[model samples]
Target: MPVVREFTLPDLGEGLTGAEIIRWLVEVGEVVAVDQPVVEVETAKASVEVPCPYGGVVTARFGAVGEEVPVGAPLVTVAVAASEGDDDAGGSGNVLVGYGTAGHSAAPRRRRVRPVQTRPAAVPAPQPTAQPAPRPARSGPLPVISPLVRRTARELGVDLATVSGSGPDGLILRADVTRAAAAVVSRETSAAAPEPAVAWDDDVVPLRGLRRTVAEKLSRSRREIPDATCWVDADATGLLALKDQLAARAAAPRIGLLPLLARICTAALARHPDLNASVVTEPDGTPTGIRRHRAVHLGFAAQTERGLMVPVVRDAQLLTTEQLAAEMARLTEAARTGSLTPAELTGGTFTLNNYGVFGVDGSTPIINHPEAAMLGVGRIAAKPWVHDGELAVRQVTQLSFTFDHRVCDGGTAGGFLRFVADCVENPGELLRYL
Candidate 1:
């Protein structure tokens, strides 16, 4: 006798609830080893490979690629051979998020086909044409793994089991449920022979995955945080010169304008620690006090194909210009490649956004939730500016600072922005802070 055990999706940590299946590495009836990566899933944070903790023949898979599966939901079922005198089904002694390793009763076994039992019966005359038996009806969970799909079906009053799935191995997707619902509406309209004057679902884009997370956080930030934005037109001539000088050096690491701006932001934060803190909330979600941070974990926004993401650079205040440039480059590459982990995507006391890359002059971007401030830099171009009491062509840029008004008064925010602007106008001013 073989014992079948169901494996549920494990938590991927960092408070993630679910993940979208990117690819399935295993197929039904295939032999698998303990701790083998069965599926690659893309969470809001990163793409991760999920391993199965059971070693046996895979009997069934619940979700298809592109379907989201919640934590603790059934992922796959494996059939393990029962050892003699052992009643328990063995599990692999491998530990992953949401589950721990456990002892097994028997060693691993190879996969084999089960023998069919035969019974003697009286033979009957065969018909000239034999028709094949109908396919067995699928039941028990509807092959739908996503809760979103189930909820959509229920809200639209669609029978999930009756609709054929277009996904791999007949797994029901959200689109399938929606199409079934649309068919029902079509039939209803055909009976009435009428047309409506409005389209509700047209041009509607779903907010899911990273976009959904960003929307919720931004909405909360706008609703709760009293934000104020201040802008300054600064002469970035010196900063560009400084970057050129560093790049012209023999051994100095090639520096960009962002590293210099990052340095300036850190210096300003150090001077005005009030803007570097987040508000601490009580149990009921009311602001109780401010929790000032001693170190700066800086987050910088990077635009990727998925959407906008903020990747944090830890202990940014302590790193040099070269080091900051290196870390920023590394994080930007990871963000572009969708390889950043959840840890790298969150937990920042401040954010630095360089919207200049997009050729925009300035923007009042919403503050990243739980963070106190965000510094935005716009494109630096040659503009007429006052230099040495005379109008001259200078490399000018727009800098905007959006801060939580509750964290500090306008004087503090103004002073911080002024200091950053001064640093941009005179790159030598950073030496005083150093």
Candidate 2:
């Protein structure tokens, strides 16, 4: 008789409530060893592979791909043998030692090694040592490449395996595909068609997943929140000088404008707490009240392959510049690699979108859900401006703030922006607060 056991989904980390099934590694009736990979799940931050805890034949799978499963839900079932020596039927059902019960054995069987025969040395001419067998050739289909590279290859008529991969794990990448396509085009110049002078219709692209979610959130934010945005042209000459001075100092990770911006925003929030609060809707669809969070959890917008993810730096008010930089670096790396947990992506009290990296002057960023306000930072440029009635070139950056009118009035938002500008204009004055 075969023993049967069920395995539940374990919490990956950070108190994640659920995850979406990306793919299943095993199928029913297949025998799997303990700790073998069974399924891949995609959470808010990243995708992780889960392994089986029981060694047995797979009996059933609890969920399918693309299904979101809650924590502690049964994921799969397997059947096992009751005992090795006892063939009798009444010895108790097959119990998986790692999962269902504690009394069952967990040790894996070890293969026995054969002892060398002494008589073989005495044999005439001593038979030649047995040659090691050659490795078996790889069978079935060729390796898989990324979708982007595949599409590019099809359009350019390039062989994927021939291209050298520079990406992680020797996998074919977009750059490699592009270079291969370019080489092909260069070699077959005579076969190329003449460029068309007439304008052609652009292909219609479909929005799904991340892009769709972003569109919905942006629309909802515009419709639900009575947003009031204010832009301020701040003189950051002093801040740049301070940054230069700090960079010269000996430190493991050099601090930059991002951490300084975070510090300034935190201090401004402290001065004007209303800008940090947001309105909450009741379960019945009525306005419950304004929810004010005491601590500042600053969310920084990080653009990733999946979509836009904002990982929060909790308790920003209590951290120093170096600490803030380290946290920002860690969270941003996690976001890029899809390793951020659900909790780290949620529970942000305020958000900041840095469009400066893209060379944009200014943009009114949408407020993340349940957050009262969002701050946008534009490119820092050296522009000629009037200072004390004299023409001078100064470093200027645009700061835009969008706030929920229900939580904070226009006056309060203006005050917060002004305070931030003051800090950026005079970094020396911020030392008092630090």
Model 2 agreement with the true structure over 1-434: per-residue lDDT tens digits = 65666566665455445666778898766788877878878754456677766777776665546555655555776665655213232222232222222123343222212222222111132223332232222333323233435666787687765776543224454556666776665556635545653333334343433454467667777767778789899988888898888889885578888888898888888888887887888654356789888999999999888788889999998898889988999999998887776567878999988889899999977788778999998999999978779999999999999998888778898999998888999987787776
What TM-score fits each model?
0.81, 0.65
Give the whole-model CA lDDT for all candidates, comma-separated: 0.79, 0.71
Could you give the C-alpha RMSD of every candidate to the true structure, in order shown?
A: 7.4, 13.6
RMSD of 2: 13.6
Stretches of model 1 off by over 4 angstroms after superposition: 1-6, 29-34, 54-57, 78-146, 154-173, 185-203, 283-285
Q: After superposition, how far is residue 132 of candidate 2 from its true place, in Å?
A: 38
Note the residue pairs that clash in candidate 2: 3-94, 46-338
- Cα lDDT tens digits, model 1, 115-198, are 222311221122232223323327764665466888878988988778776553455678788778887886766667646534
Error of 2 at 189 (Å): 36
Q: Where does candidate 2 have its weakest 10-residue lDDT segment? A: 114-123
- Residue 74 displacement (Å), model 2: 6.3
Error of 2 at 288 (Å): 3.6
